[model samples]
Target: MAKFTGDTAKKILANEINVQTLLHQHPEYQEEVLRELSIMKGSYDLKRIQAMMNKYTSSAKLAGNLIYKSGFNEKTVNTFLPNIIKARMALHLLEHASIAASAQSPTKNVRFNLWDGMVLQRLLFSKGFERKPVSLGLFNFCWKFVLNKKILMPLVNQKGIYCFYSKALIRELIRLIGDKKCLEIAAGDGTLTRFLNDAHARCKATDDYSWEHYITYPDFVEQADAKAALFKYTPEVVLCSWPVPQNTYEKHVFKTSSVKLYIVIGTRNPAFTGDFGAYNEAEQFTMELNERLSSLILPPSNENAVYIFRRKEH
Candidate 1:
């Protein structure tokens, strides 16, 4: 019998080893039994993963190997590994009643909406699993997956400020706003604005008062009431991120003078406009704006719904 060393125990707890195979080979221990034992006998839990990750000089190399061995393609592995590791650790912690109870206590908790579809979309695309089983499964289980804070904490931390911008999406946005003063309407937390700012474009960020929980930058951030600021700024390029509210104010930005570009980042589904209760008005607004603006640009990525409009040169 192969004796389980601390290293072996750590690997087992990480799901690096097949639990069923371990149990089948060692009938004396049940699968769960082996998992728990591994945790107890080795520093194979959340803290261990974090500590070992620092010690490894080549974390990326090890990550690649793990992804390959786990039967995920490069993209899916890159996208999902950080979140998966975080989720796994969370589950481990939750399995302990004391920790779980403390986490559930109302006094220790506050409110924040987890980043849902966006995070999943990035993970799926990164792992090259955008078309794979894992991606499909993630889509199906998205609600449950993101509902837990533990899974999202690592992703929020890993991606830092640009967690919202997929590399491809950012590139596309940068290309569209080339050498232009850009305005991100409904720029929650200035995520997109930050990206544009980093790309060296002149950009301003704005959001409705409701998004106070998410919007962090005061200098760039402004209340979304268009009349209050639109004519004052006169942006050459205007951008809206997904879940854009179907409001007259959004349409008004398009009407503002000297606005050369209007970009809407969302689903192509005309239904998305209506489904969110802003459909009828937004559709009418889009039609009127389309008549005024020329040269529309749309990308084919199913994950992101993007629409770009260029003002007709007078």
Candidate 2:
């Protein structure tokens, strides 16, 4: 592990260095260089190094040649390789963080290993080691490092359990609804519920617990269908973030007399209208429902939209 001091971190931030440059410049650390290079080979562009190695020596003499070229005579290649690999891994993390920060949808298909690589790179660069291997490592490290900071949520899709939802989205939701009695239907793992609680809302997170592994925070959870739960809680505000397909139970809640406000977070696609035997009668249903509600707020976004309904004042 590289002991990163304040000065080292500052140097990395200033120069934007990484592990790749470090390895290339300090050829004397050939064993370390090779080890780091090997780990990052599949991820980054290592063709240049590979070509150099191929031109210089045979498979058996590879380690010997590296040591000779790197200017290290006393150290064994085997010992050096591990440290090099670790450094490279760190660099990759940094690279990932950099990429993630600049990304539009940062949570899309994020991987943990990639984030780790970026962190390593950032640490190395911060240490003021401006070598080729180190520089490349720095870029890689920043990319991966920022990725680690992301809030990972357990998503339940048709295929099964997966990770989705960005911290930004969660933050936005918190800001939207402050402290209120909230109900989240089709709440997988109670992610939104937890977010609501963190925002100081009196929220009850509920889910069917159908998945093999379900996530729930220390909150009230009832194993019931969305419609049934609505009848029990009759919350002031109802929130559903990305409800399952064809779940007409939402419509049932919309018609309920108890709900003061109903919020549906999802796309505008009509496919979300579940088999409540109501697609053909959507116009009639919506008109009747809208008549009952005082206010309705709809935002225009292809992937995400928020529908808010307010109860009519007596």
Candidate 3:
């Protein structure tokens, strides 16, 4: 493994070093970079991360106290909002550093420090505030809390970070999808379908289980690709969450004869998710943002949208 100096870590953090190119040339180098950033005691990068944790600690405490005292009422909301923002900023610093070191080699985990674990545990799985699979309250808590993004974005590989499904989004979808059989393709973990089923919506979850490294495919999520699921289920409404950017599979959704309404939960940023080319080329459908559903997609800061595609009335 190549020795990653403090200067090298600094260069990576500054975007001076082309990590992608470096990784392409020497894939083993990524491990070294991750080690230096996360494991090397007294390293500059580690110190920077520790400093950010300190800031996050102070801010989270202040925000948590305000919420505890006033129950996050209107008057207390504004007062603690600044502290929440500060916490987010502090966590972002760690996120940036983790991404800078590990994005190129995505399969390798970004190990968080001891302090990071405590902060993240409180943010994700705190008692009395535990929102099991998905909830608007949970999403709001995560969005308002800084440590949420830090723990989620950095600790895991890219495959782990999918769209956060909110109860509001699911409820809105249930209303829009009334009477229509819905199917979710690429259904990682099958959590969404579990929620939808609980809401009594007729939706089946299916996936090829390709991302098994990070995603746990429940038995409810039938093992199949997008094309296979669409053909077998033959649902009227097809749903997908964060389809791989510019992937070939999603075009199959447009081709399926029974799919009249296709809903995609993803970022508007074309480079981030979904195949815009397929969406544009699929002339038989009229695609537009479902404004109400879009607003319901959780965490608020993720800037995700719920896109609706209806077969044109020919």
| Model number with the top lDDT | 3
lDDT of each: 0.47, 0.45, 0.63
Work out the TM-score per prediction: 0.41, 0.41, 0.58
Root-mean-square deviation of Cα positions for candidate 3 versus the true structure, in angstroms: 19.0
Per-residue error (Å), model 3, residue 101: 9.5
Model 3, 108-198: lDDT tens digits are 3555556655544554442432223456665565555453344454344354544455667777888878989999998877766777888
Which pairs of residues collide in model 3? none
**TM-score quality measure for candidate 3:** 0.58
Model 1 TM-score is 0.41
Tens digit of per-residue lDDT, candidate 2, span 127-233: 32211112332344453535454432211121222223334445555655566567887676565576567657777777655432324323455665676677788
Choose the strongest candidate by TM-score: 3
Candidates 2 and 3: which is better by lDDT?
3
